[model samples]
Target: MPDLQRTRDPERWDEEEPPTLTTDVTIEQPKTIITRNQSPDIAFDRSINAYRGCEHGCIYCFARPTHAYHGLSPGLDFETRLFAKPTAAALLRQELDRRGYTPAPIAMGTNTDPYQPIERQYRITRGILELLLETRHPATITTKNHLVTRDADLLSAMAALGLMVVNVSVTTLDRRWRAPWSRGPRRRASGWRRSACWPSAAYRSTSSSRRSSPHQRP
Candidate 1:
């Protein structure tokens, strides 16, 4: 898909009203699992997002606006409202097994956090990881949730083969940062320190971007 702004014409706002969400659940059955990107700044050409509209509800999330396409507000709706692609792992395996498939590192946690709360039960990310391990495919993940630790054993084995790396985001060290508007933020600096030894050495912003204002309703 094109950049959000480019895809949404400003003048079209006066021509047609945007859609609205009737319920918090959204069932998105996508035709493809991996999204291809040719952006210069990105490290990978393809990515897989198991779900849409993160329940973490980070106000600063760039993915928030995505829910608007389903006629949902980017605020509360982006958190409470959710969509899952149940066949993501199966779809990924199919693509990887395709003829002339070249194995490049596949990125996850791009559009939405793959290890979010629902992942505990849904286990879509874990299934994908298992498939990656079976195929010896290189996979990378960037997430804010500690739930990634649940798959530490698999990750450790993959690390031995140089097939996996994980980056855990620490948007803030302040407890105040944790609320409906944002996901859990590390309240202790030591907590952030321990995460540094993970395969990726850097943490995401420990503070929200100063330029953007919270998109709260009136």
Candidate 2:
């Protein structure tokens, strides 16, 4: 892998501030979007990752190592460099329309976050949800970003059909630890309120601490 870091001359280092790392996104046109898995340890058989790298920068993210496959550092580069699948929804539509296609619950955010920061611009995940809703297909989403709530309309519609479920992962409630650990996801309170917007939808919480539990608005 090449040096992704920006270096400065020794004498100028004292005079100039260190360069800041910025996120860069590369568009990838994949022939297919759905990934099939048959691992007995996994709960879902198929999954879709709208983005390749997660901006959340979770220290313990299992997907970090995947960046190594692209000749990039699995540390900082994994968070700064990302790949988006703009054609995912189109490809998925084709796959769903295939003659012998079978419908099962497609999973999102299994490898990387679908609603990561970049999704705000690309809106690839939202397109996928629209397609799924059109086809009346089932899907399951797991995310740490509150951006997922932006699709509450789609989610609630699917939920009314008993076709959608969401899992929100909360690593910590304390901002002191959370700020340094997962750099992008919002605070627990905000995420809880946004998640609650999905009426009648099945919501689950995954947390490292037992103290972090699901908060329902009654």
Candidate 2 vs. true structure, TM-score: 0.81
Q: Over the stretch 1-218, how does candidate 1's per-residue lDDT look in tens digits?
A: 85565365686646432333243555567888989999999879999999988877776789888889989889878877788888888999889989998889999999899987788878889999999999999988977776777787777778778888776666555664554433446432333344443465335443435432222111
The parts of candidate 1 lying over 4 Å away from their true place are: 1-24, 179-198, 206-218
**Displacement of the residue 168 alpha carbon in candidate 2, Å:** 0.7
* lDDT by residue (tens digit), candidate 2, 185-205: 345447557656453232333
Task: Report the number of the highest-TM-score candidate.
Answer: 2
lDDT for position 157 in model 2 = 88
Model 2 clashing residue pairs (backbone): none
Clashing pairs in 1: 19-71, 171-206
Per-residue lDDT, model 2, residue 10, is 92
